[model samples]
Target: MATCAEEVSKTKLVVAAIDFGTTYSGYAFAFQKDYSSDHHSLRIYGIMSKNGCSQKAPTCVLFNPQGKFDSFGYDAENRYAELTLTNEHQDWYYFRRFKMMLYNNPNITWHSILKDDKGKSMNAIKVFSAIISYLRQETLRNINERVANVGIKENEINWVLTVPAIWSDQAKQFMREAAKKAGIHSDQLDIALEPEAASIYCKHISVSRRERQETHGAEGVGLEAMCPGTKYLVLDAGGGTIDITVQRVQENGTLHQVYMANGGDWGGTKVDEAYEAFLEELVGQNIWEAFKAKYMDSYIDIFREFETKKRTISPDIENRITFTVPPVLRDVYEEMKNSPLSTTQGHHRNRKLIWKGDRLRVDVTEAKKLFETTCALIVAHVERILDKEETAGTSDILMVGGFSESPMLSNAIKERFGHTKRVIIPEEAGLSVLKGAVLFGFDTRVVSLRVMKHTYGIQSSSLFRKNLDPDITKTMVKGKLYCEDRFSKHVKKGQSVRIDEETQTIDYHPLDDREEMAVKVYITDKYDPEYCDTELCSYIGQLLVCLPMDVPTSDRGVKVNMKFGGTELSVRATVMATNQTTHAEFRLLE
Candidate 1:
């Protein structure tokens, strides 16, 4: 007879993934039966949104004056704009497209506070927890309403949250804590890297030749080109950051990462910034600020339209592009400049600005310039990844994410690597991460191995060598000379680690008569470091283990185990004398 715990463990019927992107966020889920079927037979479902059944919604959140979450996604945008119209938004908190702050933060902690668009500060954990709770509630409601006759219990569903590969461990932990506050247990949650999830999703779904022809023309090759053991690059270009990784197909239909993930803030939002800068230069900063302050809603609408238009602009576009300027902006411009608008070029002759019946006409050449810096950086980074010694023989590139759908970016990559590599842009590139994350929750083994992004280790005291050890790191404990802050490396950067692989056991003893021992964890970008105080090395967190008071100091030693195969770091401490083991809580450094 099966026990209750056994039954519940075996009854995992659903896998849900939340793709919390920088500019957009959404959730997707799949039933176990459907996912286990043939790739062609599997039918993954996304959250049904107001603007049709879409995979994602805008990553926007609005709070009331009392700092309570009022709305999320597109609804939040509308609600904030409505409040702005009544001059009530000054006190209310409105955060839009703000997920990049985590990526850019150097010293993120659980107590970190985030600033709203208007510079109002709020507890980041509360803000993130509220957004996650809203998504969870909506997902549960959707499951009950859409899936008929399937009384799915909360325990039967597995949740996967997606994060960027370049994020620090502290950032990942912050998200984990936020999710727990949203009512999801740690056991039911899994952290999936954005690029890895997209790779798995693409590997399972076989893109048809006809679909490839429609997008990539006759030269387009689908997943059929990738046989077992074939290597390919995954470029996940989202709104805020671009993440690039290389993976190879395994014989059992899994993926193995060939190169460590690498990217930067060169995503689609950079282009938006460049466009705004161009507008500021053309309209003058004073007039632009006035227009924005007086017509905030109109400013948002113009960018909303640009979001759609941006995807259609191709490298081959020759005609002058036109953007409808709000009447207020035109009136403001005239009032500030004290003259009528004329067809004149600003700074560049090829880039001319003309007004045609309340519409701002820009040259296609100039519009393409806005994407030059970001697109070039993406292409250059991809080139460097392919040039690596480990990435040899890789001939296919898979582009995913919302920004990957841009024709300008797609054309740029194709033009650069078209001769040597076949670029495969899967259908609905924007939803790849969201759907791939769902597949990851179903079977994490799909990605067999991952490369360590940083060299992780513990700061410890070692026998000091007179010549090799620096005097600055020398310390005396109990009349014995030791090298303090010595970095004990467990995992090296760029080292390929299999899933769930544990590092060699490290022995630790309590210092003096203390009942607790603190293990300071440190990480560095360098492959090897002598001490934690070296450049590029940072103290991330510490794991504290309590020792039994009755036991002698010699018997109070504990064995520390670190596992780096998964996305987040896991540590366990086992007392040698009592043989008792407990998970270590790594509190982020202040």
Candidate 2:
């Protein structure tokens, strides 16, 4: 018989999964908890927040009255109307879609990003830190609020954060740094790839469960397999970027043969911009332009407000929004008033129009059409790779990330590939990766995914010649650009090499007379730099090859030996040599 005292030792720490996405972020936690009939259930998972109402959290933040939080999640969403209006003071505001802005602007800093729409100074990271800090606090709070939320302290908790599969090491490095700056514990931190994380939730232990439900139909059932050499593609179209990765699944939480991941900077937000453009066209460009010129920030504010209303109502119906703005916008206001468009209502409370004007609206069908360029290209790319003459037997296509949540997007996929190989949209489309990271962080049995590393280079000349698109090509280099690439085989742009790596070495010297040593490690997939000109993906750090000067002199070529690691291949290149030692040491540094 077990004593009650012994039962207290059975509980373990809870694990939190963080999905730090460009558009939004979310966290989930799991632990063993006591259940009905005095039994303990393992792998109890729940969304972490003040209230665990939703599994995903919007990664947007805003400043409220007096620079306070007017709303967060449903709280903020409910009062979107009240929050949209400006009062006595013409204070600025903030909203989503700033992630890419930081990259485009070189002057952007932690303080620089927090500025309101008016360019007023504020601390963006500080606000993000506050939100994340509150999240961390609320996780502990929610854990405490639960029946057995138990007595878990912050120190006892473990967490893992997931990033886009296409995120560069620099991005991950930035995240690690930012996570720390935001007060998140490094010890609690673990990094996992986005698609791999989603696979965890998609292929959860349901089949392994004692009882399972029938899984199949027109929507398609996910084929869950955690074995060696299982190949899959992760089509992650999110708010800001589209990340596509093709890799072989390993037995453990490791990836192999991961070469086929690429991303397009365009995503849903681009479509949203196009949508705004369409609405502007419906309202007349001149009118919209006038509004923009007179009231730049207010123009953006009004557009955002229109977008909010668009989300809720039918495009056929007339709708109105009321908000105040700078007085300079009065000209545009008069034009809108005089226009032939229907004026459903009017009120001038805060130096703004409180009127519903015109029958201008966009139907969902038209909205989807606006996304044609984006959707078609994404589909075409995926199809092109999948239909490659090689690897015809590849297993399946796994669609993960936030963009896959789009009903129109998925429908387009289903319409296109209904009969082909399996197309799976994981059940937990959004939070799947975060959950997968939780399981991955614990070293649990999982199908490992692999992605390749690529080093890019440009031709010594003509990298960007006139009438030519910048040549972008992938090369076989290993490791980080300035680090260990020589030891690693990374395939940049056009290199369709298999997703694995082996080591190799080559040696050569002396490009000029009396120089004794001049070598450029031209590692590339293209034989001719002219034809295969890609933009400079990468280049060698300044490394000069020079002879020992004490070596014997010669007028003929000399041979130098080099070795590559994984491939274990070696080569001796004969080059112009004026001097050489019978033997010399040449090895990679520590």
Candidate 3:
């Protein structure tokens, strides 16, 4: 009999699906095997990881001023000061969300982040890339070094990448590009919609009481337990963006969502920004106005001083901030009845004024308000999706996202769906999508990839409409080719096909023979090419199918054969023509 581990590894593919999230990134790999003593059937073992790291990794990076990498994760965060990062370089090192920038702006290139040995902050893609690259290396290390029991070769591992549902195809392509640069294998690469991945992952953990026993491995749908046609609203709040998707359970376990919405760019990072702005405003602006107005340049460290005081104290209603003022304080505001400050000890050529009190506290309340505002925006958007789903007859919502981890947000969801049914939030909310990415990767047939020009096979002229029959469902055949019949495969509506090699056989003498019953290669749905939607199905490029000199163009349905490149397809088709009858070979391209 196969070992239990072998059995578990049967259903699960021993590969990792990386969720390169904007705020956080993580990977999950499943190990499957055959474990039945009587009947040999595959069993699925879940993803394994080290320590408290359950298949997820922090997405922060750090480097030093010497352009040398300092450290990453907890290490850099702790000993930031020792790193001596180049904080002076405006373009070099910084720690901030670049994902939004990637989408919103085309000019911004990813530069790694850096921080001093104290770990303040820096700019560099090296830090981010290092963190990402290291995690990838760890995955390989565990597989090659520790995947002893798993029956898979090192190169066999496939990787599925998940991205936001609202992301543009161009943006997703860029992600794919970054992954390529990161050394992730291209064939192993795939992108899953984050919401869908989370939904799939959440389904595995179990949601309701009535439906639980039918757990048939990772891809097993909770069809039996999908809460029987209940509605759910996903209020996904994360470190960077918040997304909301409303899903409805069909007779089968699949979730069909009608509405998808979200944009909480104001996540945890926003809170930090709000706090920083508060400090920058009070100490930098307010104090500087008073100092600069008095012509005292000695107080250069005014902003830094305010930062120190703010950090030393915690939030307190009774005044959490306090810093001693320099003796020159009397010389400043009260000195010439103009803004000013005096030095404390007067050690050098001159000392400037220093004053601090309750400045940090002034922004605390405002910061909290900003945080709440971002959270509220996320919640409101989720509610809107739910409302739209209800209109579309989609009554169930499966809540998933990093922000769903927030108790504050969770309560809001419970209250929103209180009168109705309820919302389902996974225990490891953020990781749900990471897990779902695996599920999505495991099932590539149904969830095939959709790409721009690369994955698309364009038909020269789609005959969607015909003048002869307004109601004829198949309007494509109405327009017959006068010169030649060309075969187009590897492309169709809602179908995926790639052109391994794209080629066109030209009617070389069409221009020369324009008056000799010339062939006009035009795109259209109507039998009369002139009546088609020329703007949409117009001729982008054309190839003329020339009949032999002995045959007339009007009488010949010249068959043109074009073949290019090698890509997967459900069915393949070929068109062949010589002098007379048109011949074609067709296959389904899934």
Candidate 4:
């Protein structure tokens, strides 16, 4: 049996997880004692919605004129809307779906700034930290209210924060710093990839045998029933990004990633953007821009209404899709164009656009078109993954996250691969990541191995060769020729590494009597990159090792060891002369 290596199940009395999503956010937790029991259950945060209890609230935050956190989630949305209705929200800052800013941002750091819904600027870290703080408070309040005499101290609780599998290392580090600012100690927190967490949740849950047979045919029965060596695909379709991961089960009951996580920004928000684009064209760009600028509250309300209707959209629906059109939209159009909004209807080539009193009616055909591009891209990507030799024999595609709840997208997947592959959408798919994160906190060893997405290495200098080293990169060090910016690869792309496995130690000598040697980490998409400064290479983080003054100049060397198996990269250096190990943390997002 695999023992708990982290503090979650051992030293911590509670394991709480926060799913800080792009469009929605929520928390779940279970006591340690309960976690050890077979009857343990996760207490997920929920708020009442039109469809009943909602496991998550909108991922939005409100700040006062002083730029201090005012509220978050549903409260923030409501408060901002109320202020907007009264024309008093101009001074206040409101941020929605701001998490996407970190995605693909190479220069993202603690000092990065973010613009609010009204273009007001604030420190991005502050905004993220405030949201995390609110969630932390909520988690504590719930734990206190639910349990008796638990007396859970801050040190006794382990926290898990979920991020998309496709997020960059800097983004993950940024979240860690935000959590630290929210009063979570670095040691007590663990970053869980969204797709991996969802996989862990599926691993523990059982589907009805009859339902599994009806859906999967002869491929597999359910997630829990999958024996060792069974490979499947996980599509984490969230609001901001669709993260894909191919996983295979091990005999030890742990997941082994067959392929690195890969996906694009083709998510639910893309469909919303498509709908907005249609509306922009129908109302005229000038009118729509002015409406969003002046009537910001009503503009938000329009999308809020659409979000509710978006869930109910289906390919089989015959009636025209209807969206409540705030009166301000027409007023803004009239004010700008000196005519009713309907006048622009004739200008639209898409004859399906029509105005029905207080509602905007769109033909089912046009509405389906909104999902066409995103669905097509997602399908194509999935097909490409399945076609790869690595993902061969993968018969099941597990869909999780908020976007997976879309009937239209679900239909798209089923129509495309349902004939040959089993597409399993777990119950309460949106909460899968959150619940699984809680489980991950309880046992961090559920994922035994992972395939590296990029080739990771350290920037180094070695003896130059005329044929292999470019002339521009050749430089003299201590009267000898050396090649700068050489990539000393620690782990290659597509390489499988067990959890906490350390790479082979490489010794390095300080150049030019430098007091400290900097281990600059770089990553690349290529399997083998020779240079670190190439177009395809990206410098991620660095670790500095101090050289001992007592050691001779030539003997001042450090043996660097890097652990590339976990969600974050860890480095430790051993002094060559003293044989003493110095664990150094990467200064990520600096």
TM-score for each prediction? 0.93, 0.61, 0.56, 0.93
Candidate 2 residues 1-590, lDDT tens each?
00111122223366666666555666667654332222212354556443342356555555655776544443443344343443322453444555554334333333445555446555555555555665666666666666353487765666666666555433444455556676766656656666656665554432221111222332334344546666666677777777776656556534543454566666667666776675455446777676654454455445445434323432233433222233434446466768444343332222222224323233344544556777787888778777765446567676776667665566667667756655666554656676676665554223332323443222221122334432242222333122112222223333443212222323332323454343323234443333322343333321234444444444434544432211111233333453343332211111
Query: Can you give the lDDT of residue 224 in candidate 2?
Result: 44
Top-lDDT candidate index: 4
Q: Which portions of model 2 miss their true places by more than 4 Å?
A: 1-12, 32-55, 63-84, 88-93, 101-116, 120-128, 147-149, 205-229, 250-257, 285-337, 342-365, 387-391, 444-449, 456-590
Model 3 gets an lDDT of: 0.45
Worst 10 residues of 2 by lDDT: 1-10
Clashes of each: 0, 34, 66, 0
RMSD of each: 3.4, 11.9, 12.7, 3.2
Q: Can you rank all candidates by lDDT, best first? A: 4, 1, 2, 3
Residue range 1-590, candidate 3, lDDT tens digits: 00112123234446477766665666666643221231112232334333343334445444545666545443433343232232233322334245664445433234433353234554434444555566676667665555567546645666666667655334454555556667865556666667767776655555632223322344434433455465455555666666555555545555554343345465555644554554334335555355433332223223224323332333233332333333332444444455543223232222122233322123234423435665576667765655652435544445566656555455555666645644566666767787777665655432223212221222333333445423423323334423122223222222222222323433232212232222222233332232222353433222323334444544333434433211111112222234343322221100
Provide the overall lDDT of each model, using Cα atoms, as 2-decimal numbers. Answer: 0.81, 0.49, 0.45, 0.83
- Model 4 per-residue lDDT tens digits across residues 1-590: 01123644577888889899888888888877766766234444422233343568888999999988899877887788788777898899999998999895778887899999868899999999999999899888888877647566888888899999898888888998999999988888898999999988877774424347755585565344667888999999999999999999889988999999999999899999998998898778888988887777787778788887888899999998888988878888888888665632443674666685678777888888889999999999999999999999997898988899888998999999999988888888888899889889988878988899999988999999989789999999879999988999999999999887889999888886767777788999898899999889988887777777787887778898877778777677888989987645677777
Question: What local lDDT does model 4 show for residue 98?
Answer: 87
List model 1 lDDT by residue over 1-590, tens digit each.
Answer: 00122123235888777888887789877888876666445677765465642457878899899988899987887887777778777998988777887888878866788898778999888888888888888777777666768677888888888999878888888788888899977778888899998888787675545447855677657445457888989999999999998999988887899898889999999988998998877778999998877677888777777787788789888998887677777788889889976644453334567764558888888889989999999999988888899999897888999999899998899999978987888888888888888877877767878898899988998888999999998888888898888898889999999876778888887658887788788898899987898767988888777777778877888888777877777777888898888546667635
Which candidate model has the greater lDDT, 3 or 4? 4
Q: Which stretches of candidate 1 lie over 4 Å from their true place?
A: 1-10, 37-40, 52-55, 208-211, 214-225, 343-350
